[model samples]
Target: MKKKKQEEKEGEEEGRKSMILLSERQMKEIYERAATIGAKEALKFFEAERKKEYKGRADKRLGNTKLLLRNYHMLKDHAEKSVFGRTQMEESALDILESMMSMYDNEVIIESIKRSATRTAVIVSHIETMLGLYEAYCDKSRSREIERRRYEALWDMYIAASTMSPKEIADKQHVSKDTVYADLRIAIEKITALIFGVDGLTVR
Candidate 1:
């Protein structure tokens, strides 16, 4: 009886070992599948994030283009002015305390404004150059009539600083309001690419 009991105990030990080994094999297979799935999911997530970032950058570029065009005249005026001299800074800060006078002399603010003015001048010059090219192109070929209309629409709406409404622009262009709006949009898209580079062009 004691020998039989010992044999039964040995059989139970062997069974437990077999079950453990089977479980380990199954776990390894599950882990491999999970890793594969996780990698694919990670890649998809990364791609989606990249697209969002790209779209965000494109939108920002478009917004900047619109802003620069709208403020074209004002920026040009600012660009023509020389940087503030020491006397000018002192005069501007005359009311402030002596201790706070250093704020007026802050090179950082002055440099930042100077840089902004320079960039504005550069962008405005690009707009003018592009418009000049467009004018020449429009005149060179009657087939580009629609393109010419779009260019005129953009100029009247922004570059000319005219107070003309969209309806007025449409009447002047001899097109529907919707056409004028579309032209303006297309013009802005083209200029956005010019100002911000090719990547500024949105997919849509």
Candidate 2:
């Protein structure tokens, strides 16, 4: 009877292993498909938005840095919504986004300074500041991209680790943690495809 029980335990373990493999494969497939669809839709939205260009003037009388910072905050709010889609990101991602927004804010301020300042030294300082901000922005953008990829990877790992339990994985990631866990469900389905074979992962 002990031998029989041992055999039964082994069988259950093997079954679990098989299920894990199958779940991983299925999750990967689903991730790719959803990512592809999301990418295409995001691209379409970006292209449409880009085509609408409007001209604006910077007021020299106003503190350009403050105004630009305000605008940056507004845009950042919109960007966070667009990127995370109601999901809270890790502190790292938020830091990178904030830095990028600050760079943009500084860039606008420097441009205003260049136009308004009469002293040659001040103009040069503004120019230097703008250049520095631009470089910083580029670096931050790259880092943000890396962080985003990491987030996706970690999420997938969590899903696999949790045995495809949507609620469990969400809880681990500190994402939704409530409701029906729709975001996590969609993310797992789409991210699997994205990591495996989907193309055009560019942000829209």
Query: Per-residue lDDT tens digits of candidate 1, residues 170-192?
Result: 88878899999999898888777
Model 2: per-residue lDDT, tens digit, 143-197? Answer: 6653443344333433222333545555655665443255433333333222221
Can you tell me which runs of candidate 2 are displaced by over 4 Å? 1-22, 54-204
lDDT score for candidate 2 against the true structure: 0.40
- Model 2, poorest ten-residue lDDT window? 53-62
Query: Which residue pairs collide, candidate 1?
Result: none
lDDT of each: 0.67, 0.40
Stretches off by above 4 angstroms in model 1 are 1-25, 82-119, 133-143, 161-163
RMSD of each: 10.4, 25.7
Q: lDDT, candidate 1, residue 202?
A: 76
